[model samples]
Structures are given as structure tokens and as C-alpha cells.
Target: MSAMLRKWVLWLLGLYFVGGSGAALAALPIEHWTQPDGARVYLVRNDTLPMLDVRIEVDGGSRRDPAALAGLAAATAMMLGRGVGPHGGQPALDENALVEAWADLGAQWAATATLDRLSITLRTLTRPDLLERAVALAARQLAAPAFDAAVWARERDRLIAAWREAQTQPDTLARRRYAQAVYRGHPYGVEATPDTWSAIDPAAMRAFYRRHARACDARITLVGAIGREQAEVIATRLLAGWAAHGCEPLPAVPEVAPLERSQDVRLPFPGAAQAHILVGRPGIARRDPDYLPLLLANHIFGGGGFTSRLMREIREQRGLTYGVFSHFLAGRHAGAFTVALQTKPDQADLAVELVRESLRRFTVEGPTDEEIAAAKASLINGFALRLDSNRKVLDQVAAVAWSDLPLDELDTWTARLAAIDRETLLRAWRRVIDPERLVTVVVGGQP
Candidate 1:
């Protein structure tokens, strides 16, 4: 080959590699559509991996269950993967079979409860045959749940036993009481009691399904090894048949107004070695205008790991607790903002004092310029690591759809962090995270 031709070829190859790497670095661009049945669909295609992960979330989660039937929504979600139609298998047996099939095909399926939604998730190799079968089973689970009577009894008994065991754990007991005290009369406060589980008869499950499990309220997200066209078809097949009915509106969770003093709830656990502490109040929702700014601010306050104020004050400086951290919940509706720590029972009072002081300082002065810059850099630099897998990317897409964030939100996140100045951080901190209303719960000691 001529020298000139060789040089041109090398330059072209270099450019191709660099450009291709850039395109891959840009995760998957989000695409959106409304299904013919009116459900929202969000799609992101990442063909780098030979797998697909899908998540379907329906709104009105536990909130749709009647106030009298507190655990109904969760119970109904549990019933789904147990069996659909004539399959009529127990939850564990059905789940075992499903897992076995997924293993046979190198795939997976599962379901879970979140504060505002119930999610059914599937992951599978992108081969046509395995993908087809996996999605078909997912559709059956969604649209044709059997909620058999015998299965309900066993699940109810299991859940009751779990609840009973949880009550014996000081941390669990404190959280239950804390949630009830903080979010009374709202679905947020409900726990899975034997009574609540008993309220979940097959009829109740059917009623909750009819009310809350609608394609109209569903949001479907697909990521990995698929284009927009393929994602749309898969989503349609999986979700289109859900009974098209709206659910009831969520019961109002009243704002946590300031109490004269922070309420201290104490529960004893005999033979306990440590005390578990939780402190904070009703935080802003995910869609709050201050969401990004507050998230950035929180990093400096406690969410930034070793660099945070809580760690410096509580763990590193005084050594009151092994670990201490703070975070806002950012749910579909307002959720709790919390600072949590576990320390020796004898040191509980000292740990609580330190956490309170750290919070007071953060709210008062906000973050310094150096702290702010480091937090932003930490968040931006670490952000790419979050989308490292197809399943993780699907989670981000589902969160965006559920929280009504913009499709281009992830792409713009780093730039947004860079744009946040010190003043912006203080403005968000002052508005959303109030110091006076923070509820304090400590379990295992008198303190």
C-alpha cells in the first residue's frame, strides 16, 4: 500500500473508535409514547449488552387500598407472581418455577412494593424465543392473576409471622411507631399486621386489582438490546390487556407541622447491644422544583459518605456511632427526610446530640464553596457508574417516568450539578428541609 493511503486509513480508524466510544458513553437516549390504550411507555435502547430488562409500574400503590384494609395493595402485588389463571400454585412454589425457567434461559423475573407503585420487573437474554416467553408470562401475571384462596391464607400467615418477628427487633419496632406517629391516617403509616393481612381476602385482592392495576395508570420502561420499534411492541404486548379502570386518589398525608418540641419515642429491647436512631421530617416530593439542588446540598450534609457533615461530626470526630448519614426520601408524594445512626446503647444520647447539631449547622450556614464544589464533583463523576448495567438503567428510566422528570434529565444531570452555585444550595436547603418539624426516634435505650 502507498504511504499516503496507509496514513489516511489509520486516521479514519482512530476517528471511528473515538466517535463510537463517545456514542456508547452516552447511555441510551430516552424515547416516549402513549400506547393505543393510553398507557405511557418510555424506551431506551442499549445494544451494547445482549440482554433486555423491563419494568412495569402502576400508580396508586398502597394508597389505593381502603383505609380499613391497609395492607391490601401489597398483598395484591404479592399474589400476582404466585399464579395467574389456572396455574394455581403457591407463591414460593410458583416463584421457584419461574426462577428455574429463568435460570434455564439465563433470565429473571420479580415483583416488589414501593410507596407509590407496584413494580413487575423482567430481565432476559435478547434471543427471540426466551424474550418472547418471558414477556408472555409477565403479561399473564399482570392481567390474569388468580389470587387463590389457599395461597392467600399461607401468604397471610407468613406475613403475620414476619410482622411478629419484626416487632421484636427494636429498630423495626421504632420505625413502625415512628411512621405511625409521623404519617397517621395516611397510607404511609400502614404496617402489615395480622389484622391487616386478614383484611386481604381474595375478594379484597380482586377489588384492589380492579381499582389500581390498570394499563391506563401503568408506565412501562424497556432498556437494553432493543430499538424503539421493538420496545414499543414488547411494552404493548405486556401491558395492553390490563383492565382499563382508574383507581381512587391517595388519602392526604398532612404536612408535618412543627411540634413544640421534637417527639422522642423510646422502645426497649432486652439484651440489646446498640440503639438505632432516626431523625427527620416530611421532605419534598421528587417533582419539587428544588429536587436537584436539595439532592446536591444533601450530599455535602450527609449523603456524600465520608465527606459529609454527619460523618465528620458523629463518626470521625466524636466516634459516637460506627456510621451516620442523612437522606431525603423523594417519593411520588412527600416522603420522610432522615438522618439515621446505630450506636452503643450507652452512647445514644451523645449520638443524637451530635446529629442534631450537624443538621442545625447545615440548615443555618448551608455548604461552603469548597464543600459545594466537592459534592457536585463527587455526584457528577460518580453518576456514570450508576448506569453500568441494563437493569440499573431501567431503574433510572422507571424513576423518571414515575416522578414525571424530563426524558433528557439524565443527560443534563452533570451540567445541572455544575450550574449549582452556593446561593442555589442555600435556597433549596432553606425551603424544603425544616429543622423544627423533624421527628426523632431512638430505639433500645432511655435516651
Candidate 2:
């Protein structure tokens, strides 16, 4: 009954929040500081709701995984929730007990790893009682994940089964090949095989967690009704265990190298109704100087949906594919600038050529004044809506925090987008992408 009531209350809060995000976003004032314990913190105080969202970013993404153990970072993050050790006179909580505890408090916590970082997120009502317990429980999970042998065995098997199932899909197949060619000889190219999955043991996860998920590399972003003082206490408590090891230097990761020449991988999928096509090239990092211009350029090129040039030519006029779009990944290191779409197997060749040609023309001629204006209006208008609720606000805050962007990024987002002129946007786009050098993959249309 208590959990149900909590859900009902939170649901009501969400609905009430739906209408005010634009205003909240335009006026978002982010506060930034470093915790004495070495954890960097970013806070956005939104008092409209009695709820909080907390995200902890660690430098433990898949890119840190050893090639032989391709999924180590993700597995280590998953273990954080399997169980937690006893602390603060609290009982040890297994996965089942952990789930129940969060339910009782009507709060939520989860740990996940992506290509560049491992993130642990917690959300809870800000009522004094609920928030305190939620923090304590999350602190245990962050500091003392048990990495139990039994739990790891179960998780390893489940992961392997899922990966095997994904291998049977056409998109995954094309993506695998695309990643391999695009990220060749890089950590991102390494795929997890069943053998690689089975090789991971509880001990490995523990060691990886200790080395990468340390105080020195931790970043915390909080969005809620909390003030600077309370936010400090919460941040400190979260890193209590992490501070024990002290700050130390971590090894460096190499950058993603651009393709020297064009590479295309075409595979035949017999009897498949459609061809899955992926075209990509190494693109910019989050902190790239041309980030804003390229971002807007991408929108004019393909990311604007129906209004985009790629969509205008390929889908609307040519009747090639029902949908087509493109975007840059923009991670810690260079990620792929990719275009993806599916069409009838017979139309795949024409579709791929059109995409390549469209990119070539856009690179040389660039977006027209009319297209630039429309893209800017769309991007600028939609910026505020991106921060409509606490969750949405938190996501943007976390990105800025993780990318080490200016604290006022949210405040200046639309302004910068609005300031970008046409020549700058074109130069930024043409400077980064060489349509001739794209690594294209086509799967299907077997002879």
C-alpha cells in the first residue's frame, strides 16, 4: 500500500511537471563544485517537485574493458546491484532484498555502463525520511557491491544468451560489421563472444570496479529540491568508500583514428525482405571546437526528420526508403557520424548511392539560407522542451557534467545554436566528414 501510494504521488507529480519544463529549462541555473573528497558535482535545484534525481559518472565505460574481456566494464557495473555489504549497522542486502528496500522507499537506483562511462543513477522522493534511507541504501550499493559467485554465474549465462539471440537479427549483424570497420583496431571494435563472456569472474569485476570507479574519477550530477549544503552531504556520503583508495592516475586511452580511405562491407542475407544499411565515419568528440556548428549542420543534413535534406531526397522525392536519418554520436573520444535506413533489397544500391551523393553535395554546396533558418528554429525551439521534467533536466546536466562543458551550458544552449552562421556551419561539417571516405555496410540481396 505504501509503495502504491508513492507511485500514485510520483505519477501525479510527473503530469503536473509536463507543462512547465520549457520555463524551467530556459531559466535553469546549474551550480558546480568539487567535493573535498575529490568527486566533482553538478547540481540543478528544481523545487517544483519533492523528488530528486542523482547520477554518478565513473570512468568505467566499455572502452576501459580489456580486449580479451570486452564486456568487463558493463559486467562490473551490473554487479553493483547484485548485492551490497553490511554497513552503518545495516544488514547485508542481496538482489531480492535490495529490490524490496528501494520499493519500500519508493525510490529507484540502477547502474549502467556505456561506451565511455559507467553511470549509477538514483531517484527518490525528497521527503526527509525517504531521501535519507534512499541515500544510505545507494551508498552501500555504490561502495560495496558483493560480486557474488552465484549471481555472476546467472548473469553471465543470461548475457550470453541475449548476445546469441541478437546475433540472429539483421540490424545487429550489419551494425557489428559497421562497428568493426569504422572502429577498426580500436576498443570499440571488440565484440563479446560467448567465450569472452564466460571468461569474466567475480574477482575480475571487483578489481575493475576498484581501479576505475574511484573517487578521483567520479562525477556526480544531482537535480531536485536539494540545496548546496544538503547536496554536499549526499555527495560525500556516496563516496565514503571510494575515498579510501585516494586519487591516483589512470592509464590513458587512445583516440579513435579516422579512416585513411573508404571501406565498404557488403554481405548477402538470403531471402531477407529488406537490406539493412549503415554508413559511418569517425566523427567529433564532445569537446570539439566545431561541435555547435556540426550539430546544427547535422540537423540540416539528416537529423531534422521530414525537413532534413537526406529525408527530402531519399524518402519523399525518390521513394527509396520509408525513413532515413543521420547523427553524430559525440562521445569522450570521436564516435561515428552515421546514417542508417532500411529499404527493399532491390532498392538498397540506389539508396546507398543517394545517401553518399547527398552527403557529398551538402559538403560542397552546404545548406541553403532557408534550410539553415528552419533548422535553427527547430533546434532552438526544441531546446527548452528537452529539459521539461526533472529526468530530462538531469539527462542534459549529466551530459554537460560528464563532458566537462561549461556549467552554464544549459542556459546558453539555444543562444549558441542561434548564433551560428551559415558559412561556419558548412565549414564545420565539410571539415569533419569526407563522404568519399565513409565506411558503408549493406546486408541482404544475396544472388
TM-scores of all predicted structures: 0.88, 0.93
Per-residue accuracy of model 1 over 377-417 as CA lDDT, tens digit each: 67766776666567777888899999888887776666666
Q: Write the per-residue lDDT of candidate 2 for residues 263-376, one digit (tens) a residue.
A: 988898876789999998999999999999999999989999999999989989989889999999989889999999999988888999999999889999998999988887
Candidate 1 residue-pair clash tally: 0
Model 2 alpha-carbon drift over 4 Å, by segment:
1-27
| Top lDDT hit | 2
Find the candidate with the highest TM-score and give its number: 2
Q: Which parts of model 1 have CA positions greater than 4 angstroms off?
A: 1-27, 87-104, 244-261
RMSD, one per candidate, in order: 5.9, 5.2
